[model samples]
Target: MNAYQESLKIKRDNYSALESAELRGEQRGQKQGEQRGIEIGAELERAKAEREKREMAVKLKTKGMHIEEIAELTKLPIEEIQALV
Candidate 1:
């Protein structure tokens, strides 16, 4: 082939390779972002559950429940119930 034709073929191949690489990179980034989002959602749920547990412990303590009774009622450790007071 002539020099002009050879140059055009090289340019086309280069562009095709570049486009493929860019698409692969974008797909990888999207997957990573989705996984990170899921992890964050799980962490938020765990934090909410822990907060609810603390609130219940505080409420039971306010009712003047003994530490042992609180432990029995709340099913938490005696020391943990005492600490709540």
Candidate 2:
């Protein structure tokens, strides 16, 4: 091939390689973002559940429930239930 034709072929090959690398990087970033989003959502759900359990423990305590019973029913630690009193 002429020198000009060879140069054009090299440029095209380089462009194709660059495009492939960019696509792979984009996919990797998207996957990481999705995983992070899932982790954040799970953390929020766990916090919400913990708050609800604490509220229930408080109500049970007000109704004259013992600390041990409140801990068992709410799945919270005795120390946490005592702190609510």
Which candidate number has the best lDDT? 2
lDDT of 2 at 42: 100
TM-score, cand. 2 vs. native: 0.91
Model 1 poorest ten-residue lDDT run: 67-76
Give me the runs in candidate 1 sitting further than 4 Å from their true place: 66-76
Cα lDDT tens digits for candidate 1, 1-85: 6999999999999999999999999999999999999999999998888677767888978988677776676667777767775
Point out where model 2 deviates above 4 Å.
none
- lDDT for model 2: 0.95
Question: Candidate 2, residues 1-85: lDDT per residue as tens digits?
Answer: 6999999999999999999999999999999999999999999999999999999999999999999998888999999888885
Candidate 1 backbone overlaps, count: 0
Error of 2 at 19 (Å): 0.5
Clashes of each: 0, 0
lDDT of each: 0.84, 0.95
User: Pairs clashing in candidate 2?
Assistant: none
lDDT of 1: 0.84
